[model samples]
Target chain A: MSTPLLEAQGVRFSYDGRTPVLPGTDFALREGDFVGLIGPNGAGKSTLLHVLSGWLRPSAGKVRLAGRPLRDYTARDLALHIAVVLQREEHTFAFNVLDLVLMGRFAHGAGTLGFESEADRGIALEALAQVGLEGFENRRASELSGGEYQRLAIARALAQQSPILLLDEPTASLDLAHQRHLYSLLDRLNREEGRTILVVSHDINAAAAWCRELALLQCGEVVRRGGPRELLRPEVLEEAYGVPVAVGELEGGQPLVAVRR
Target chain B: MSSPTPDRSQARRTALWWALLAVAWLLVLGLAPLAGAAEISLPRALGFGVPEGEFNPDAQILFHSRLPRVLFALVAGGLLALSGAVYQAILRNDLADPYVLGVSGGAGFGALLVLTLAPAAVVAFLLPAAAFAIAAAAVLLIYGMSRWRGPHTPPATFLLAGITLNLLFGAGILLTQYLSDPYQTFRMIRWLMGGVDVGSYRVVAFVAGVGGAASLVIVWRARHLDLLSLGEQTAHHLGVPVASTRRLALFGASLVAAVVVAYAGPIGFVGLIVPHLLRLVVGPDNRVLLVACLLGGGVFLALCDTLARTVLAPTELPVGVVTAFTGAPFFLWLLFRKV
Candidate 1:
């Protein structure tokens, strides 16, 4: 009923001329929706997310955010409204976590290339607190464990104060406990903070358990889009993945998935 | 798991260490002019009434010659160090320096060309401006070549282009050297040696003015420099205009390096060594690292110049030679330690 917070109207892209990565893809998101994008390798899930976040431009069609075309917003303007957490952390310099988090406010104000004001520092500390990193702000980022680094990145995104969050494989390298913690954090942001989140993941069970709606992509096309109950069925997943998978339920009534022998 | 809070007392202690280092640097720079070939009284040096004695040529020599040279070394050293720190942060490579990117070679070639072609042109102001223009052109050419395909010039590709340009310009310098007569050859050699005979007060003021202004601009952009330390993609996602910011940084650093190289004739190693050493002491926050580099470089070069004059007695070794001898070994140590 309400205008979608983000919309992709027939987006298409190709790295090389002949082979298309995303073929005429159309998608939209409403406010506070937790959407999971799951697909096999080469399904262009990451490309779709990149386009939505304005990191990539589509060969054809348009991507609009908050009813404005992506091109209408400067990179800084877009960044103020959307935050992307990439998969790998490859920083060459050693910066303390608090300084790194404070960088999220770079697009906000004016103080010598937009210095960190008191309000900016307050927001950074609050974001760190949200990600359970309140006291680790003085630690060097290079010294962080993989899970701690991921949390720090989420904290940075939170400091951006963006309404839209895009995460690429947030749990891929995380341990089990960290993975659960990350999922709960995402859920909290989406439900309580009213942030729209779109996650690209390979973990089907995590997707089925946490996402209200899931889109199954195969060969650069959405094969199925529905509630998790419908999309997690054995037949639909087997079609998308091209492998036999058993879909079952746990005692808490969440969907569980496993590869069939 | 609970995270450990940073101890306030420890942070205060770290600040105190920085303050002590700053004071030590100032002391070294202040006292260096006194240690030259001549012996001047502390009272005379401090402008106290001169001792009731014959006109001390020693004090005159110290005031007129060594003090200005020492001042040149201090300012140029700080400029080179700050430029190096900015370059390393912007390029996201520790080995990156304004000189290494062919700027020094281009500037040298430009100055030589001007000196050879227009022998009558005033050497004071025109020479340095010509050198800066040529060096900036070389940077723009490299940047253009790297970006012919797209807006983004990846760090690896830019570094490769810079290395190639450096070699090409270095060869050009050799050609210029070979084609010249004995008079030209002697002048070029002296220039290459990076001595501090800056001729007059006007030159010193010019260098200090430019270096001082550019350093302030860089310090103001310290926050952006921090964002840039994260790889370009991450910086972009965090709202940095990676391409434009990088270009601006290179341009600013080039201006600073060109000014110093023009005045001092391409002093070696102060840029590379000062930033590297400072980074080891104070982590990689550019805000702190840049300031430390300015202080450390000024002190280090001032001390080295003192040694250059006093160590060889009547015959002074070129400060550049001392810097290379000191810097090359430290660079080797860094590589091995990093490995």
Candidate 2:
């Protein structure tokens, strides 16, 4: 098999020294893959994402991106290759929508601090339009709705123009319709643009409907990893989640999951 | 790599800001000397058709006395406001200033120590040097304390250390004032009030030389400060070299504050007021705001110093006193105003 675009080898992490958050976790993502990471709380999903994104270092192992050790790349070089959408962001300076999005071009620009090029601004505008925020250029971030802000963040990451995108609970604050739009957007980005995406989400049905691959995490380990058809069976999910879950099919044969009450 | 051409509108916006700042500088530098306690003829101060070697008191007052004092206020105000803006951005605290970090307190203590203990003749030289050294030491102490535990010095840690240092240094200044004799106590009071009284062109030169170098370093990091203000982790995610930028910013702010304080006493509120007010007017893009702080801050102090001398002619109020009067109301308004 070709080398995985992003691979974590026996990665282990902890907030404090004594307890392990990711105890010898291993994971990998291939090029052009749209994968969903689903796990209950305290399952180390966010910790693994942090490790992969170079925000946190693994105590026992290392992550590699495109066959190079993650440690070998500087933060700027990493940002040029990977863009991330975090669960939370801060906007204390009242930067406008365009200004916030243009920051994605920070690594791309040659200016020392924040002088974005005309081309960079054009690209940022394009990204904002891509995320359906075309007219929000002048608005302050504080004025945006929660869903719009999430899309705004994605727009900013899109301006990074990176091949790999990682998101952690991107739809946590989003309403149902917004979540649906976000999932469809991700699916389109994955299918049409052939971007590699790994989203950590709690929406199992949404993941099963859109993601080509699903990984079930529990106790800092990927217990079941496969195509949705192979991994969405009732017994598989029941074991991974420690609860009985009903797995049914829609008219399109996509898996629909619900707690068996 | 070749530098990309800046966005057309952004470039235009920045240029407009620069032009406005230039106009402000010219107006302040021109009119401030005129409104002082002693008036001077503009033509004489401009040195138009005056005999080359003649000693004219009007010209002398303009060039040697009034202009130097005005210029000193400009540089000193610029440094305080610039340092405040840098502190506000880097520390992610709007209230953060050189005074908040105890830099001004250390400087006040240093000046009083020199006034009380140093020989009379050497005081002109000793006062500024001692203040600069001691103020710089206080900032270093705060900087070092914040980073002692880990690689990252969270803004909270930095502000906590600064607040603690402020308390310690404030007590030291009070003790010095208490120990001094009546004559020295009078001198100490003047230093504590923070004024624009210039002794020589040398002190102005000293402040401009050191403070100008520090200002360049701070302004150069303006872009990074924008990202860093978001949060360190996000800044790192966006590819800012967070540690180096923080280090350089702190160094620049501390040096600028110490030098200005040494030369002009611990002039308060210019740092707090100028940057905050400009941010409201121009938005908080540090590229524009930091530069604005330099020019606008100088103009502000010069005007306030003009008020100081003119408001109670012959009995000059301290420049700090004027700023405090202006800033306290602004601070209260900030607390009460609707967002």
Please report the candidate that would top lDDT against the real structure.
2
Residue-wise C-alpha lDDT for candidate 2, range B1-339, written one tens digit per residue? 222234776768777987898798888888888886776788886777688888777877777877888888888888889999998888888888867777888888888888888899999889988998888888888877767776666787888877887788889888987887888888888888888878578888888898898899888878888888888878878888888899899888989998888877888888987888889877888888898888888888988998998899888898889989988898789768999
DockQ of 2: 0.44
lDDT of 2 by residue, A47-77 (tens): 8998999988888987999989998988789
Error of 1 at A91 (Å): 2.2
Encode model 1's per-residue lDDT on B1-339: one tens digit a residue: 434333344355457657876896778756887886666787765556766665766667766777788778777888899999998887788888768677888888888877777656576567777777777787888777877857666777777777887788788888988999889888888777887767566777888898889888888777678888887777778887777778778877878888888778778899988898888887776766777777788887888888898997878888999888889999989878952
Model 1 Cα lDDT, one tens digit per residue, A151-257: 88888888898899999998887888878878898998888999999999999888878888899888788878887877798888788778998988898778888
lDDT of each: 0.81, 0.85
* Residue A8 miss distance in model 1 (angstroms): 2.2
**What TM-score would chain B of candidate 1 score versus the native chain B?**
0.90
lDDT of 1 at B224: 72
Off by over 4 Å in 2: A110-114, B1-6, B44-55
* Candidate 2, residue B76: lDDT: 86
The reply for model 1, stretches above 4 Å from the true place, is A16-18, A108-126, A129-135, A251-253, B1-22, B42-59, B120-126, B337-339
lDDT, residue A74, model 1: 78
DockQ winner: 1
